[model samples]
Target: MSTDTSARWRLRAHAALGALVAALPAWASAAPRFADYPVPAIYQGRAAQPLLADAHSRNYATRLRDAATEKPDFAGRYVLATWGCGASCTMSAAIDAKTGTVTWLPFTVCCWDADVEDHLEYKLNSRLLIVHGARNEQGGGTHYYQFNGKRFAEIRTPPRHAPHPPGDHQ
Candidate 1:
C-alpha cells in the first residue's frame, strides 16, 4: 500500500480500537482495587499450620510454615509468604489462616530495576495484590491480581502509572 493509504488505514484502526475499549463494561475495564474486593471480615481464628501438598509448597515448606505462624497479612485470613529465590527474584505463596491449604503465585518475579524494599504489595484485609517486576523474567511492569480464597486471578487492565524520571530509580 502507498504511504498515505497506510497512514489513513492505521488511524482508522486506532480509532476502532479506542471505540471498542470505551464500550467495555466498567468491571471489565476498571482497575482491580483492594477496596472493591474487601474481605468479609477480619480473621479472629487462630492461624493454622501450613499445609504442603503441592510441589511448590512442599519445596518451600520451612519458609511457608514459618511465615504462616505469623498473623494473617493478606486477604484477612491468609498469610502471603514471600521469599527471595535469587538476587532481585522473589517467589510467593498464600497460606490460608483458617485452613492450612497453600497456594502459589504461579511464577517467580525478577528482572526489575525498582528501588522498593519488596516487589509484592498486599494488605491484610484486601484480596487485591499488586506485583511490581516481571513474572518469570518476561517483561518488567506492575501486575495486579485478586485472590478468591483459592487461587489468584490476574487483572489484565490495571491502571498504568507514569514512569519514573530518568536516573531516579526510587
Candidate 2:
C-alpha cells in the first residue's frame, strides 16, 4: 500500500482504539467491586483459617473469612466464609465472630456456568442471603434465606430479578 493509504488506516485504527478505551471504564463501573461491601475491622488483619477443625471442604484447605455486611445490630460481626468445594462448586459458611462457631450454608454454588452467572450475594440492609443460579436443571432462580441469629432459613418469597443471569423462572 502507498504511504498515504497506510497513514489513513493507522489513523482510523487509532480512533477505534481510543473509542474502545473510553468505553471500557463505563463497562467496568457497572460491575460490583469488593469495596462496595462493608468489611468489619476484625476481618481486615486476620488470616484465613480452617472452616471447621473437623469439617471437610471438597478440596480446599482453608476458608477465607469476610464480614457479613447486613444486620449490623446483631452483637459481634458475623463472618461470611467461603471456599471452593470442587471445580464447579463453592461452599459458604457463616462464622459467629464471638463464639467462633461455624454454620455451613446449605447450597453449593456453581463457580462456572456457560448458560448463566451463578453466584451468592448478601442483601445490604437485611439478613437475607440470596443464592442465584440453576440448581440441577431446575432453571435459573434466586433462592432467599434469612439468618435468624442461629442458622440461615430459606424464605418462601418470589425471586428478585438480577441483571447478569437471564431467564430466572422462580
TM-score, per-candidate, Cα-based: 0.73, 0.47
Candidate 1 lands at a TM-score of 0.73
lDDT for each candidate structure = 0.79, 0.53
The candidate maximizing TM-score is 1
Candidate 2 per-residue lDDT over residues 43-119, each given as its tens digit: 23232332454435323333423333323222134566666657766777676555445566766776334654437
Residues 11-116, model 1: lDDT tens digits: 9999999988877854364445667768898888998998888786777889998998899988888988888999878888899988988988989999765575
Residue runs of model 1 more than 4 Å from their true location after superposition: 1-31, 157-170
Report the number of the highest-lDDT candidate.
1
Clashes within 3 Å, all models in order: 0, 0
Q: Which stretches of candidate 2 lie over 4 Å from their true place?
A: 1-54, 57-61, 64-76, 111-118, 123-125, 135-139, 157-170
